[model samples]
Every structure is written in structure tokens, then in C-alpha cells.
Target: MQCVNYLFLVLILTPILSTFSAKILGLFLYPSRQHALLGTALFAELSAKGHEVTMISTFEQPMVQKKFRHVLVDGTQIRQKYSPSLMSLNVSMWEHIVFSNSEMKYMIAELLEDSSLREFLDAGEKYDVVVSELFAEALLGISHRVNATTVSFNPTGGSYELDYLSGNSHPYSYVPNAFTAYSDEMTFWQRFANTYVNLFCAFSKHFFNLPMQRSLLKYYFPDAPPLEDLMNSVELHLVNSYYLFETPRPYLPNVVQIGGFHLQKPELLTVELLKQLDELKNGIILFTVGSHRKLSDFPVQIVETLFASFSKSSHNVLVQYEGPPPSNLPANVRLMPWLPQRAVLSHPNTKLFITPGGRSSVVEAIYFAVPMVGLHAPGDDDSQLSMMANRGFGVCFRLDEELREEQLSGAIRNVVADPVYKRAIMLESELFKRQEMSPLDKAVYWVEHVAKHKGAKRVKSQPAAAMPLYKYVLLDVVVASAALLVMFAFISLWLCKQTYRVLIRRRQTEPVKHKIV
Candidate 1:
């Protein structure tokens, strides 16, 4: 009877005790609200799953919950200091890269100088895992300081930098680099350009970006491990990429795609907004230049052109513009400082989405099965919108001074009139939805998996990451093969020359045989 009771108790406790709670620290200090949203959603889910999550970010959480702590940083000051002209699209890709590196350096210096963060660091707190965005690698030193497993996060689709950190293969022939506006199927010149851009970016990151970050890391965390070791110690990479929409690329075991993890169940729109949307006879068109940018950043002429185009459209327009409303604002166009983007997109009467091709906006549009007219702003938006255009789901155009009313209005009119664009996006939405596990669930599982095991050392590709550059590129093999071919060619030529010489010598040695010819 005693043995039986003990066995029953053990079985009961097995299921209950199997649940493990971990102390997690999330460092998402990037200034972008969209980036914060991704980090918040992830940490929120972890907190709900019984983990103690403390997040340091630039944005505030919508809802506060137990087991979750929020530490807010003043990202606006950093942005103003480093990137005064945040939304200028006139710069080239190289210029943008240089500017971003400088901004990240300034951001790191500011983050390290925070008094609260310094106190937290000195508190001797230990965490099982530290999740951080890959934008600022110096922040990964916090994980080392706290004695936590490092998990790097990418808010956009995976880049070559992430691939290198996670030891994932990046085939440049098919996989477009981060900056290019090209698809998988590329012409020779496109492939060449992709390879060139990838190399250039890699060179810049290593020689320019990493050194500055290392200097900052050394200055801030004198006793912490080196930045390279810290980066190599990152056991898992979680990317906001789904293969259905993003081009299919090879991923390593430690690299997980948790795209659309930020998406939540659509919330009910305000009653007044709902009534207005329902009253529109023709469908509605939603236009927003994403969260990070405002309409004021756009050229005055371009804004005027957009207004003119919106006025001519038959459908009602909802514009998320932060600038002052124009005196000539049309009756059909409504300008609000902010809009409930997800709710508006999920509405049945929403016909089209006109955006500046931010990743979050594009993903949301795809989720809601709304066709888009992409006025691509600078940065990766050009490539993102170009991919959408190539896939036949949207039409992409440069958001610049040259944009005219006809071009803007015509693209919107065509996408709205044609059912093909809608059908394409709907198919994409279905494919994106057809996943065995939700992206958020997968992300949480992996975070827990790392915490449960203490680290993901067993799953990491050690050999691939440790391999030398020449070996990784197979240059040695190519050189050896070329040498062997050259040797064989030389031997063949020597044999032929000897044979010809022998024939000539034999004829010279033979008696009087030339007259027969």
C-alpha cells in the first residue's frame, strides 16, 4: 500500500514538475517601434509561459503582466543625435551602410551610459537566456555579463551576417543579398551585382562595423569576453522570415525562421472607424509609410501628388499621415496621425494597401490578403517591394520626387481593378498560414529548448563556423584541379612534339624517300 501510494505520487508530479521556468533578459534597444513590437511579442509570450522576462526596449508594452518587467530607454535622443535625417532616400546603399554603422555605434555608447542599465548590470543578476537584436552586436556582451545563453534575433529576413554567425549556407547565385532588388532567378549581371554587393557589405561589416563595436564593447565591459567570441557563442538565431513569402534558402539547425511572430489576432476597430469603413460604397484603400517614417519626410511635391491621386480615386482613402493636414485635402481622403493598421487590413471592405514597403507592413498586407502598391522608400524596402512585384502580388515604384499623380493613381487603380493581384496575395496568405506550428510557438519552444539544455552547443555547426575562409569557398580544391589540368595539357603537348620530331628524324635517316611525294 505504501509502495503503491509512492508510485502514484511520482506519476502525478512528473507531469507537473516537467514544466521549467527560466529567467530571460531581452535587450532590444533598436529605435524602431516595429523592432520593439517583435521583441515585445516574443518576450510577452515567454512571460505568459511562466518564464520571468525582463525586456529593455525603446517602446512601451501595450499591456503589463506579472512575471514581465519593462525597462524603457530614450531612443529618440539617440536617433536625434546620430540620425537627424532619418528618412532621407537620396543616399546610395554605401552611404546608407556607413550612416547606419555610425548610428549603431552611437546607440551602443548611449545604451552603455544608461544609469539604470549600469545598476542592473551591477546587481549580479543571472539569467538563463539573453535575447537581443543583431543590429548592435556589442549589446551581446550583456549576456556574457549576466552569464546567459545568447540568442540573436533578426527583425527582417535573415541576412548574410546572420548566416555567418549561425554557420548557414548563403548561395549568392540564387539568394539575393540584403541590399539588392533582385529575385532568385537572376541574369548573369544580376548575379554578378549580388555577389559584388554581398562582398562589399561583408568587407564593410568586418573592417569598419565590427571594429567600432569591439572598441565600444571593450570600453564598456572591460572584463567581458571579446565581441567575436560573444558573437560565436550565440547558440541560436531567430529570424523574422517565412519561406513561403521569403525566398527559400538553406538554414542551419540552430537558425530558426519565426516570421510573422509579431502578428496577433485582429482586434476590434473603434466603432466610429468601423462605421465609416462600412459606409464606403466602393472598397477602401489604406496608405501608410510604416511606423518609422512620416509623410513629412516625403518631398512636398510627392506628398501633393499623392493627395491629388487619392482625391481622384473612387474608393475611400485612409492615410496615416503625421504632417499637418493640407487646406486642399479632398473629401474622399482622411488623414489621421495614426491608424489601427491590422484592424483596417483585416476588414472585409479593405481593397488595397499602399505602403512604403516596410517589412512589417508588407507582412501584414500579405496576412490580410490585401494587394499592394509599393512606393518603396530607401533601405531594404526596395528589395522587399521588388520581390513582391516579381511574385505578381504587388506593383513597386520608387518613392521619390519624380513620382507623379498618374503613376501613383494608375498603379493603385490597376491593382484594385484586377482580381489577379488579390488572388496571388490570397494564395500566399494561405501558404503562409499552412504551418505545422505557429511562429510564436516555435520561437518560444526554441528559447525554452536552449534554456532547458543550458545552451545549444550540441546543435551548433562547429566545423562550418570554424572552417577557414579559403576552405569554406573551396578555393584550394579549385586551384588543385586547375594545376592538375595544366600539368596534363603540358604532358600531352610534349608527347605530340616528341612524336613529330621522331617522324622528321626518321625521314632524314631513311634513304632517298622524299621523291615519292
Candidate 2:
């Protein structure tokens, strides 16, 4: 009877005791909604798994869940200061780097001074893990204060900076820079350009971006660890990238690719929307420039060009615009303030997606098997658009004041009329959907793995992470090999010369032996 009772008690408590949860803090300080979506989805999943999650962002609360707490930071001034317009597309890469660094410095300073964030920091809350976007360096101070393992998250494909943080090797020869339009295969000039951009970005980040962040962090959180220490202490990187979208690249043990994890199943379309799309028998072209830019902000000439091009399209056009409908709006075109992008793409009528090549939009298009006619603005997802075009499922056009209606219309017509684009994307969609484990499950597992292992120290690449750039790239070894080769060549040449000299001396000293021969 005693044994029976003990077994019953053990059985009753086992299930309850095995259920584990961690206190997770997520910091996504960027003001863009597309960037916020990635972090919000990850935290929402963690919260669903019974973890107590506190999310801080500049955007509004995403979801209302029992275990999920949201802290909103007012970023109105920051957005106004750094708002990108269509004209920004014309800015040179060097100008962009300088401008973006300035924006990051301003944003960090503003975040450190926010009253609500300060209150949250002073609350003495403890957390098991801290998940932050790639740019949120100052906010890592919260992780230091709470003594949590840090996980850096990138909303797009991993960059050189992220690779450095996770100790992942990104060879500049083949692996194109995130901002460049080149694919894995490159010409001599293309490779040179890619390498130059990668080095420039690395230099700027190390010298300008990081030092300014450190100064602000020090002023705000004097007791916090050094910025370099905090950055290096990060245990894992969760990047929104995959093999299909971002060509095959090497990832370290601590780096996790969780692309498309935020994608939810397409919901049923609204009755009115379904009706609107259903009436279009030919096909539908869904057009949107993404959340970061507004059609209203576009220059009059560019907007007129877009309208004129859409007017010539045979397919019904669905434009996602915020301003009043144009007086000359074509009969084939309809404008909406927002779009149910996934749902619309899932519809059978949505034949071609016209987008500005935003990362999230590109992923969604691939997920839904919709062919794209990308009007890519500079500094946008030009690389992704290039990839899509290389795969033969999309057409890319430069979106600028110089864009002509005939050029836009012809590409749109060709993509919509051709079946090759559809076939190519359908194959890609099949591969993208064939993952063994869902991205969300994979992301959650890694986050928990880090928490359970107390910072996941075992998986970290200690040597690579601590290595200086010279040693990391093996510059010293190359120099040594070149020096040795030169020494060997010199020695061989000297020996040949000496042998000739000796033979001549022997012949001269041999008297009349040569005459006999």
C-alpha cells in the first residue's frame, strides 16, 4: 500500500513539474512596422508556450495576451528626423551610410532618455533571455542590468556585422553584400565592388556607429558593462533568412536561420474584397511599396508615371495608397489605404505582385507562389529583387524620376502574359514549404536552448569571436607564405648562377682537356 501511494504521487506531480517557462524580454527599437513584425511574432510564439514575455518597441502593442506585456516607446521625433522618401532612392551609397549612422545615433540617444523605458529599467525585473534587433545596441544595457543571455535578431538576411557578432564566415568573393544587387556569381568588377562595400560597412560600424553607441550607453547606464563586452557576450543570432531567399551561406553553430517564421496562414478575404477581386476575370496585379514609404510622399512626376503605366495594364490593378484617388485613375485601377497582402496573393486571381521589393513583401510573395514585377527603389531590397529575377520568377525595374511608363508597362505585360514566371515561383514555393520543422518551432527551441544552457556558452565560437580581423582573415599566414616563396625563388636563382660560375672556372683551369673532346 505504501509503494502504491508513492507511485501515484510521483505520477500526479511529474507532468506539472516538467512544464517550464522563462522570463523573456524582447527589444525591437526600430520604428518600422515590417521590422517589428518579426520580433512580435517570435515573442508571441514564446508567450504562447507559457513564457512570461515583456516586449519593448516603438510601435503600438501587437497582441493582447495574458503572459505578454508590451512597452511602447514614442518614436515620433525619430521617425520624422529619419523618414525616407522616394527621393532617398537617388542618394549615393556613401551618403546613405553616413545618413543611416546619424539616424542610429539619434535614435539611440532618444531611446536612452525615454521616461517609460527608464522606469522599466529601474523596476528591478529579472529575465532569462534578451532578444533584440540588430541595431539596438544601447538597449542591450537592459540585458546587462537583468543578467540575461542576449540574442541578436536581424529582420533581414544576416549582414557582415551580424556575421562578425556570431563568428560566422561570410566570404566577400561569393557572398554578396546585403545592399548590393549582385548575386553569388560575380564578375571581376562586381566582386571588387562587393568587397569594397563590405569593408566600408565593417569599418563604419566599428569606428563610427559603435563608438557613438558606446558613448550614449555610458552616459545613460554608467553601471552597465562596456558596449563591446555586451555586444560580444551575445550567445545566438536569429536571422530572418533562408537558403532559398538568401543563397546558401555558412552559419555558425550559434546562428539560427528562422526566415518566414512570422508568416501566418492566409485568412479568408473580406466579402467586399472577394467581390472586388472576383469581378476581375482577366487577373489581378497587387501593388504596394511597403510600410516604410508612402505613395503620397512620392514626387508628382513619379506618381504620374506609375498611374500612367497602370492605366495601360490589361490586368486589374489593386494599388495600396494612402492618399485620395487620382482624378485620372484608370478604370482598371483601384486604390486602398491598406492591403491584405497575403490573403490577396493567396487568391487565384492575384497573378502578379508589383512591389518595391521590401524583404517581408518578397518573402510573402515567394510563400504564396506569386510572381513579382518589382519596381525596386534604391537602398530597398534590391539584392532580393536581383535574386528573384535571377531565379526567373520576377522582373525588376529601377523606380526613379527617370522611370518611363512604356518600360514599366512592357515588363508588367511580359510577366503577366508569360507562364515561365509562374512555373519558376511555384517550384520555389514548394521547396520553401518543405521544411521539416517550422521556423517558429526552430526559433523557440534555440531561445529555450540558450536559456536552459545559461547563455549557450558551449556553442559559441570563442576563437573566432575573439580573433582580430588580421588573424580572422589569415592575412598573417598569407604574408608568411609570400615571404617564404620569395626566399625560395632567390635561393634557387643564386644556386644556378653559382653552378655556371663554377663550371666556367673548372673549364678554364682544366688546361687542354676540352681540345681532346
Candidate 3:
């Protein structure tokens, strides 16, 4: 009877003990608001599942759970230091790279000195898992210090750099760089350029960024393991990418594509906005440059061109402009400081979306089945928007194009007038909707699984991380084959020459040529 009672007691306590929450630390230092939102989705979900989450970021969270703590970092100086020029659209790739490195260094130094962060570090807080944005690899030090499994998160899609770290395959021939305006099927020159750019970026990261990352990690956590080892030691990489928008490519088992994880059911539009939208007899067009860019920063001429196009179009143009409203706005145009983009897109009257082709914006547009006219900027925007155009769901024009006004207006007219764009988008939307689980659900599960299992050792591709470059690319085999072929050719030539010499010597020595003559 005593043994039966003990067993009953053990069974009753097991579930209660297992229900205890795990502690998670999230360090999301990306300065962009949209990127912050992505990080927010992650932490908020973890907290909802009864995990204790401590997040340090530039953005604040309204999450009121007692288990959720937000350590808002002051990114004002960092933001100002790398602030993109509003008046210019001609920033070079090298300049962007330099600025990005500078930003990472500054953030790392600041975070190290931050009193709150230092307090946690000094106190030796224990966490089951540490989450950080994949950029600024030095931030992985947080996980190292806490002795927690690291999980890298990327609000943007995958890239060769990230692929290399995660041991994912990204052949430049078929897998275009996220920054280039090329499709998977490339011309010879395009492939060459892609390969060159990938190599350049790889070298730049290795020579320029890796040293700084190592220095920072050493400065903060002198006893920690090597930074490069810690970077790959990252158990999982959660990327914001989908095979629908991106070319279908094999990813490392540890790399999870949780694209559209930020998506939620569209909120009901305000009555006033609904009524206003209903008044658009020809339908509405939503224009947003995404969260990071200020629509007001557009050059006067560019704004004039957009306005000019809007003036001629029958569609009601609703612009999400951060700055003061433009003067002499056309009656058909309306400007708001902010618009509920997802809600606006879900509206039946939202006939089009004009954006700078940021991944988040493009995903929302496709999710809502709205045709788009892309005013793409440099960087990944160009490639993503270009891919959309290639896939027949939208049209893309570079923001710096001399004839942008004409192109923008033409694209708008064409997309709206034709049924093909709509049909294509509807098909993609249906396909996107066919997923068995939401992206957030998948992300949450993987994150929790990594923590529960102590790491994702089983899912990680072993050969990818362990294989050296020469072996992985088969360079050794190619070089050996080439050397063999050269040796054989040389031997054959030498043998032929020797045979000729022998024939000549025999004829001269024996005097046999007289008979032949």
C-alpha cells in the first residue's frame, strides 16, 4: 500500500515539474524597426509558451507578461552614425559594407558597457538558450558568456555568407546573390559577376569583419571559446525566406526557413478608413517605402514623378509618408503618417501595392494577393523585386531610373489592366496558404526543440561544416586530373621525338636510304 501511494505521488508530480518554464535570453540588436518586429514575434511567442525571455534591443515591446523583460538599448548614436542618405540613391556596395562593419563594432562596444547588460553578465545569469540576429557575429558572445546554445536569426533572407556559416549550398551559377538583380538562370557574364561578388564579399567579411568580431569577443569574454567556433556552434539559423518568393534551394538541416512568421490575421480596418476606402470607385493603391525608409526622404523630382503618375491614375492613392504632408496634393491622393499595411492590403479595394521591394513588404503583398509595382532600391530589394517581376506577379523599376515616372505609371496601368498578374498572385497566395502549419508555429517549435534537446546536433549537416573547401569544391581532384593530363601529353610528345631520332640515326648509320631512293 505504501509503494502504491509513492507511485501515485511520483506520477502526480512529474507533469508539474515538467511544466516549469525555461529561461531564454534574446539579443536582437538590429536597429531597423521591421527587423525588431521580427524579433518581437519570436520572443513574444516564447513568452506565450511560458518561457522567461529577456530581450535587449532598440525597439520596445508592449508585451506585459511577467516572464518577459525588455532591456531597451539606446541606438540613437548608432542609427545616426550609419544613417543612410535620404537625398542620394547612389551608395556603393563597398560603402554599405564599411558602414555595416562600423555599426556592428559600435553596437558591440556599447552593449559591453551597458550597465544593465553588464549586470546580467556579471551576475552570471543562466539561460537555456540565447537568440541573436545573425549579423554582427560577435554578438554570439552573449551565448558564450551564458554557456547557452546559440540560435541565429535573420530577418532578411539567406545569403552566401550565412549559407557558408550554416554549411548550406549556395552555388552562384544557379543561386543568385540576394543583392544582385539576377534570376536563377543567368547569362555567362551574370554568372561570372555573381561568382566574383560572392568571392569579394567573402574576402571582405573574412579580412575586415572577422578580426573586429574576434577582438570584441576577446575583449568581453576572454575565457570563452574561439569566436569562429562559437559562430558555427550556433545550433540553428532561422531565416525569413520562402521557396515561393525565393528559388527553391537546399538548406542546411540546422537552417530553418520561417518566412512570414510575422504574419497575423489582418485586423479590422477602422470604420473611417473603411468608409474612405469604399469611396474609391476605381479601387485603391497603397504606397509605402517600408518601415526603415522615410517616404519623405525621396528626392523632390522622384516625389514629383510619383505624384505626377498618381494625378493621371484613376485609382485612389493612399501614401504612408512619415514626414509632413506634401503641398498641393491631388484630390485623389491621401497621406498618412502610418497606415495599417496588412489591414489595408486585405481590403478588397486595395488594388495595388507600391513598395521599395523589402522582403517583408513583398511577402505581405503576395500574402494578400495584391499585385505590386516595385520601386526597388539598391541591395537585396533590387533582387527580390526583380524576382517578383520574373515570376510574373509584379513589375519592378529601379528608383534611380531616369524614366521612373513613365515606367512606374506604365507598370501600374499594365498590372491593373491585365488579369494575368492577378491570376498569378492568386495562385501563389493559394499555394502559400496551403502550408500545414504557420511559420510562427514552426519557428517556435524548432526554437523550443533546440532548447529541449540541448542542441540540434541530429539535424545539423555534419559534412557541410567539417569538410574543407578544397574537398567540398573538388578542387584537389580537378588539379590532380589537370596535372596528370599535362604529364601524359609531355610523355607522349617526348616518346614521338625519340622515335623520330632513332629512325634518322638508323638510316644514317646503316646506309639503308639508298635502296629507297
Candidate 4:
């Protein structure tokens, strides 16, 4: 009822508010397909708000091209979307790059030095504001050049935010996980490691020309904060999460977490789809290795094991196999090149989701509150999947390990039989609902607010970004020490002069004749 009332008020006032005409030139630098959709949705939403918008993407997605005509650059130069192979790196190398705080700064600086892209950016005209994807730091200089309000749009769930906001500590600060308010969770060594990372970033910044940092400040309007809180530079933070999936963080007037607002509802299944779903008597378990892994890449032995196990069972399985759907399908098993994930997840009959713990997949499952079974694979494996299992939402098993088919099957049976996991998810779903306003309304209001205000400076305040770690802690003790030492030397010299004067006076009185003559 309250929601209805709010909607009614918004509808009534919307026309009055429509007088403000704004234009947003969307700039995204990444080659990922997902970023393309985000760019599209943002362009579309802004357009719906009566804002003139144009989208530029490195690659085109079907969803984005439906509405916004995009200019495509060479994608071969861009990293492949969802490439897991590049995810591998030693801790030392990762640490060095991250700690120096220079990695993002340097990369963005080098990237923006492009003459042709600069031409596009230079062509960007009298827009009310520029909302660049976080990766589009490449456009910071351009944004500054255009005198546009620069806002950063981060799609990942607030994992990238610590670089810009203040008061949050290190390590646990950068790693995005379920939120726990401060306690002894981070150890001494971890804090030191994180500190070095920020320092390195600041140190590295000196080597780059000042244009990147200057452009960052010109548009982002953070509290003139330190390098650690770089992401805070955006006037508005469009966090890609809803209240249900996250714990309550006291959001500022500037930050909004709007997830699933643009997500289309699960489409109704075709009769064949319904018929196929109904066939899962024991239960249906949906599995995909996520986007990058070719299903053919899995060991044939493991594939054979899965088939053999499901073939014997009465339970039905819909496995997203990339290669031609396997022949000789059993009565209880089906192979699909793909299935509408949300539709299957929404099915009342669907029992459990067995997947590699990709962030998107996890969020989707959480939105439905389904328990997961993570078949964690090697390499770019289930580092995140393991975290989810540890969170008590799911169980994980190595796909290439000694865990036999029966062992995997038994775990599935347990998750299905136990009512607790499902109940916990339902509770989380309810929290999601309570934690946020309608994602659409929240997002629309913020975008307009940026335009109406004409810049983020009106709302962007979290001043912690302005100071380095040492300065924030007031560790300028060396300055104080130097002052004290100077004062002490002056006092000693004065005393020595006085003592010499007294001794000379006494000597003159006692033995003036002999010595002076």
C-alpha cells in the first residue's frame, strides 16, 4: 500500500519534474559484453527520464543495440569477455600492482592517450553530465576537457568502492564479501600489506602526467581524498546490489544500490519447457561452468561420471553443455545449449543449483534464494565458490578430484532434503525487498538529481578520500620533532653566551692587569 502511494505521488509529480532536460554521453572503455548491457540500460533509463543520451561501447550486445546505436571499436584488442585464464596471478604480483595504487591510475592514463578516442571524447559537447563506466577512466581527461559532470558507474557489487571512500580499513576493505562490522577479523600483517598497496598507488601516480588525476578530480569531486579512495571520485556511486543481497550499510544521499531494476522478469516457459521441467521427478539440478569454460573442456571421465550417475537416478537434470547436446539422453536427463536461468530458478520444482560460483550466478540464485552446490574446478576455479560454501549457503566439491559421482549425488540429496537452506534464502529475499526502494525508482531519482543539480559536487561528500593513510592518522610527528629540536638549539646557544659573559666579567675583576696588558 505504501509503495502504491509512493508510485502515485511520483506519477503525479513526474510531469512537473520533466521540465529539466538533461543529456548524458555514456562512455565505457571495457570490452566486456556485460558492460555493454549496463551501458544500454543506463542510456535507455536516462532516455526514459526524458534525458537525451548516446552510448559508446567497445563491443555491441543484443540488448544494447536494440535501443542505442553504438560505435564499435576493435574488440580483438580488448580482453575477451569472461576470460578466466587471465584471472591467474601470483599474490606478490597482484600485491605489488594493487598496493602501489598506481596500476589503475597508470593504465587509465596510458589508455586515454589515444588520439582517435580522444577525438570522440573531444567531440562530446554541451552535455549536462558524463557518466563513465569505472573502466572508462580512459575518459577522465576528456570529461574534464568537456566541462561535464563526471560520474563513475561501477557494476560490480561495491567491491571496487574502497579506493574512493574513507574510514574503511585495509584488506577486508578491498575484498568484497558479506559485511561484518569491525572486529578482529583482519590481522596485523594483512593491514600492513593493504597499506603498502595504497602507498604504491600514490607513489606510482607521480610518474604519470597530472592530466589523469586532474581530470579525475574535475569530474569525480571526491573529498580531494587520497589514492586509496579513488573510486569515490564519482559524484554518484551506482552500486549494483539490492538490500536483500547485502547487509545494511548506511548509504549516503549520494550512493544508491539498485540491483534487478533493469532485470527482466523470468519469462513464462513454453509448454515444451514446462513438460521438460515436469519430467524431473526426483528433482532437477541445473549446472553450468559459467560463461568462459567450454563444456567440452571438462574431462570426459567426469562427463561420463555425471551422465552415468544421472542415467541411473530417477531425478532429472538439465545441464548446459556447449558442444552439441549429447546423444542418447536418458528419460530423466536433458542437455540444453542454454536455458533461461531465472525461469528455471523460479520453477517450483527446481531443487538445487550446481554451478561454479560466478558473481552473476550467485546473485541470481540469491535473488531466488536457492541453495547452491559448487563443483569448484581448478585454476580460475571456485575461489569465490569456496567463499559462498564457507558462508553456509552451499557446499563445494572439486570437479577433477576423488569426489566420485555418488559423493556428489549424495550431497545434492542432502541439500534437497534439508528445508533450512531454502528457508534461509527466503529470509534473505525478504531482506532484499526491505533493504531497498524499487531499484528503478531509486536509480531514476539519482540520475535526475545529478542532472538537476548539474554536478555531483552538490551531494558528493565523504571527505575521507582527501588524505593519505599517514596524514589521516595525524602522523606528522616528524614535523613536530623538528620544531622542538630547533627551539632546544636556540635556548642552549643563549645560555652559553650568558655563561661566557659572566666568566669574562669575573676574570676582568680578578686578574685584569696581567692578562689584558
lDDT for model 1: 0.84
**Stretch of 10 with least lDDT, candidate 1:** 79-88
Task: Give the local distance difference test score of model 2.
Answer: 0.84
Stretches of candidate 4 above 4 Å error? 1-18, 62-68, 73-84, 87-126, 145-147, 160-162, 165-233, 242-253, 264-275, 278-282, 297-314, 324-333, 375-387, 398-407, 468-470, 477-517
lDDT (Cα, tens digit) per residue for candidate 1, span 195-262: 99999887888788889989988998889888878887888889888886567788888888888887
Name the TM-score of candidate 4. Answer: 0.69
Candidate 2: regions farther than 4 A off: 1-12, 85-87, 264-275, 278-282, 478-517
Q: Write the per-residue lDDT of candidate 2 for residues 1-517, one digit (tens) a residue.
A: 9999999999999987898889999998887877876778889889988899999988887575799999988887767667663126666657767865676677677877788888898899999999988675777888888889998898887677788777789988888887787888889999999999999999988888878878877988789988878878898988888888886778888888888888753446899999988888899999998877788778788999998999998888999999777778889988999887878988888999998887788988999999998887765648788889899999888888879999999988999889999999999999998998999899999999887777878878877777778899899999999999999999999999999999999999986845664
Error of 2 at 474 (Å): 2.3
Candidate that beats the other on lDDT, 1 or 4, i.e. the better one: 1
Q: Tens digit of lDDT per residue, candidate 4, span 173-223? A: 434222221122445665555456445444544445234555555544333
Residue-level lDDT for 357 in candidate 3: 86
* Quality of model 4 by C-alpha lDDT: 0.60
In the predicted model 2, the residue pairs found to clash are: none
Evaluate residue 388 in candidate 1 and report its C-alpha lDDT on the 0 to 100 scale.
89
Per-residue lDDT value at 516 in model 2:
60
Model 4 RMSD, rounded to 1 decimal: 8.5
TM-score of 3: 0.88
TM-scores of the models, in the given order? 0.90, 0.90, 0.88, 0.69
